[model samples]
Target: MSDTELRNDGRLEDEHQLDADDRLRPEFVDAVLDAVENGDTEEAHRLVEPLHPADIADLFELTPDERRAPLAAAVADLLDGDVFAEMNDYVREQLIDALDARQVADIASELDTDDAVAIIEDMDAEDQREVLRAMEPDDRAAIEEALSYPEESAGRLMQRELIAVPEHWTIGDTIDYLRGHEELTTDFWEVFVVDPAHKPVGTCALSWILRTPRSISMADVMQREQTLIPVDMDQEEVALRFQKYALISAAVVDGSGRLVGMITVDDVVHIIQEEAGEDALLLSGAGEGDINEPVVDSYKARVRWLIANLFTALLASFIISMFETTIERMVALATLMPIVAGVGGNAGTQTLAVTVRALATNQLTQSNTARAIGREIRVALLNGVTVAVVIGVGVSIVFGNPMLGGVIAAAMMTNILVAGLAGVLVPVTLDRFNADPAVASSVFVTMTTDSIGFLAFLGLATASGLVG
Candidate 1:
């Protein structure tokens, strides 16, 4: 029998068995393609059935867009909510567009509020409304309330399906209620104990409930101190709290401190990933760097930064222009000029990256801002002296113009010292004005270093009469 036939018949040798990475093997992909081409739906389904939802999502992502519809159709029911939820936003939006509103709603209803909202929010407004119309009234209302919150807030990240019981309920009652309510959330680490007005008072872990006596009241069994996330709180703050407290799950409350939803580790995992990615992109002046972002959208986001950089570049050019007479007199000044500027720019960038990250993580705040800036200035002074001596001696010998060499070396030391100060101070100043430091810091820092580098180098050369 052929290898494919043997494999299909469950008679493949151990040598033919696929390793973890081999599933995406060219031959395996070809085999699946061949099955699809030959209309062998069963073979296609069998080939992909063993993969995890995330793997399935990956498979969809790797497949050409043209082939995704056919592959999805062949797999049919295998494209469950889990697989859909795990898909890339681009792929998910495409798949959702192909599915009917009711079909999309049915899939969403099976997911947690956060996942469902994530999928629904990506759809067009009309489609989102239609999908909500198809959901059960309670599910629709919960999702609507979640949607009411600002994007990237705790309210939107929280799951409306949570386990909460009256404080008066005993441990046995809570357990029985949990077992009896088929409609309750399937995944939860803690049950909230609430007052009659639905205000959260305490939380009881599932383990505690299971271990406690049947007659123990939830109010007595539950821990009174619990971290509650406010609905309007930023998702980043929520992530910090989770990280700080080592929280598996935390209750999300509204203005009245009434439990509205719950934020779990699983949901927080996505938030953490997103926030980290956002910060990285912001630091580089790349806004929301999604691969699937439309060309026009990407251009709009990036062009502004490029233009700002152009203006900054011009500022550096103006400073260079002021030293035109010096450069015309000694061409060697032009050659050595870039060395000072390049080193200073690089040093500035390093300090900027560190300071931006510290600010984002709340490590550099008003309380320590002055101290941090002072420390950077000190470090910069030390680095400046070390770099100056090395470059001064090296250039003095190479050019045989000790005065020119000394001028360039002195400029390097001065510019680098200023670079470090500008790097940290620019970000802090922008942040104080309620601007994102990462997005604007690079532009400002580059401007400062370039302008200062040119001014220091050329100004010193002219003053010392080295290039007259």
Candidate 2:
């Protein structure tokens, strides 16, 4: 007989695995839902049982909202901690809302501290309290203490589950202790060594411990240099520290310098993704931008930006109004003016994106800001000259007016140069003032490029008597 297990549906276990797309196939999802709809909970369980926890989570997400609770009921046994951890925030919240406090507590209990806190943190205040009350005392305390920390802080992100030992213990003692401790966390790459006062002094990777002589003291074998993350540090900064040090996991220290928890690279990965996506959405003034976000919430987040855009656009319109007579004299002026402003706006946006990313990644800093600005200016000058030549020749041929061409060429170059400067300067200035550059940079940069482009082009046209 083949070693691989065959399912009741006549498919091998290997065939039941998730595909590369990280999504369940349509037919498979339909089959599961059909089973649930027909009230065949056992068949629904059988179909979903072979999928990975993450795939199961995706299945819940794929299921429609009203049907989600029914599906959850059908596959209640599969709705464990791993599935909950991998489920989307919106979907998990929906499911959690339907469960009783005890059920939620049971699910939270099965997860690591970080994942458990993630589940509980989204609950309504009273629901959170009730769920906390339903949890085992120890689990409740851990969740409550995590809750005490500010959201998005390291304290809230770190897991209380870790392996820690005294520095004075020998390799033999450490090995014996590890083998004997039934309650110790199963997942860890390194063992932290703490002083008598419970302050982390060093760390010893599992390989090092296993390779070392049994008589070697933990103090002697452990690497003394360690990155200790402050519990109160922001998650972004925490991710930076992990990235900078290439850490697998770092010890989380409290105000008293005691080792309280550990932040693993796995958790850092999530934070990195969240922060990167957040800055990107903020740049476009799109709040969260998660499809799971409520309609009203999405509207509230986007409408303000549209309103702000209306006002900024009016500012550009006002600039055009100032040159109304010049435009009316030469219709060509109106046709060509948009080219200068449009190209300049695109150039500005490109620079703004780069500057914002550099700032976020710490690639751009005070010491390098001047050199960075100079570099951008040089690039802008080259870009400006190139675009100016193309637009200049095109307009000269199209309008059959060499003077008008010269006016636009000069205007394009001037506007692009200003756009580049405004792009870098706007974000840098916002960062300097402790404001989030990504949140407001585009609006200001667009305003600068548009206003300057119109002013430069029309002013030159009027001055040269081409428009008159």
Candidate 3:
């Protein structure tokens, strides 16, 4: 964060490499790349040395694609496992592809099993094997076990590195054992107390262990109640558990109930952020929505959703065709249709967003489904009536036709009711069938609002004889 004049030119003048927010300065990034491009390796190193690992990762992401390899080469000594861990997935993949198997293995060996798996899991299969071969037997074995589990499961997300000791050990003995070990876990908040079978009996926080007399037994100090995560539990569910319990760390266990690994709060924070962002993108029908995603990949992801929306729109179009004659009679009906559909669509989206979030967070469940639906319906009724009165009065004055105004008002109220119902029902039904509601709910909700909106307005007009 401090200033260093690593270069003479005004563009390269480093008042500070990072701003107050800790992000790498735009000019700072330019200076590093400027140094690298000009073959000033020492200058590049001097400019980049002040950054944290996360900021170093950001520098790579900010660098141009062609310059990334060169920038990486210039900062080769700085590109450790921590930098790679903080990096964006696609950006890391781009850089990983440039490294040889041994070089990749060296970096992976320095990280915990979970971090190593993140780097190696996306690699090409043959190249992955080569990296594994280059790694030490212990690191390779740990990573191989992690990769065998389903991606994004607790098994894949938990780190093999953790502290576990027998419950019978005295606090003094535990302290001695910890000090005696040269290869114990470097960072942990709690020491897991396990039974003779290595099944966790309780967790002893560092504070408890440090505060208590060392001569006291660990069993006397450990808290028996502890949250245990299933190895195969999905990471999203894992994050929920962590958030619900306010856990700093939890032991991950196998089906047989043996402690396998640990998930810390730091890792859960990333999963929580990732799952939240992913849900938002899915609701919008955008896949992944990563900025570093290739053009073809983004196109493939977005076009399918657009195509699905296109087909749903055709359904709405067909409904409109049924009332062509009625629309032609009033002319004004055409102008008002979009307003009904657009407002109803917005209302449905509002309901859908709330319902999906509730479902994801376990706030909405089978026991409360009826209550949630009823609550939304009541809100929708209020919304519908408020909207109906405004549009009804405006239409009556503007066109000087109370009958026409009445028809549009009735149509608006009916459509809004249908939209609210569809919004809640569509996602809940999808959830009931074990489908992901966020990914598929929007299409159906929009379709229902548009089709029902058009049908209600035109049908009410024809039925009311307003057009005749």
lDDT at 98 for candidate 2?
Answer: 93
Error of 1 at 143 (Å): 1.0
Give the backbone clash total of model 2: 0
Q: Go through the candidates in order and give each one's C-alpha lDDT.
A: 0.86, 0.91, 0.91
Question: Which clashing pairs does model 3 show?
Answer: none
Per-residue lDDT of model 1, residues 1-468, tens digit only: 112222444342334345676666556676676677789988888877777788788888777778888888899788888998898888888888999989998998888889888899878889989999999998899899888999989999998888889999999899899989898878898999999989899999999988999998898889999999999999988988998899999999999888888999988888889888998898777888987655787889899999999999998898899888789988988888888889999989989988988887788999999999999999999999999988998999998878877997899999899999998999999999999898989988888888888899999999988865
Q: How much is 115 displaced in model 3, in angstroms?
A: 0.7
Ranking by lDDT: 3, 2, 1
Task: For model 2, name the residue pairs that clash.
Answer: none
What lDDT is reached at residue 187 by model 2? 97
Which sections of candidate 1 miss by over 4 Å? Answer: 1-18, 25-34, 37-39
Error of 3 at 443 (Å): 0.8
Cα TM-score of candidate 2: 0.95
Clashing residue pairs in candidate 1 (N, C-alpha, C atoms within 3 angstroms): none
Best model per TM-score: 3
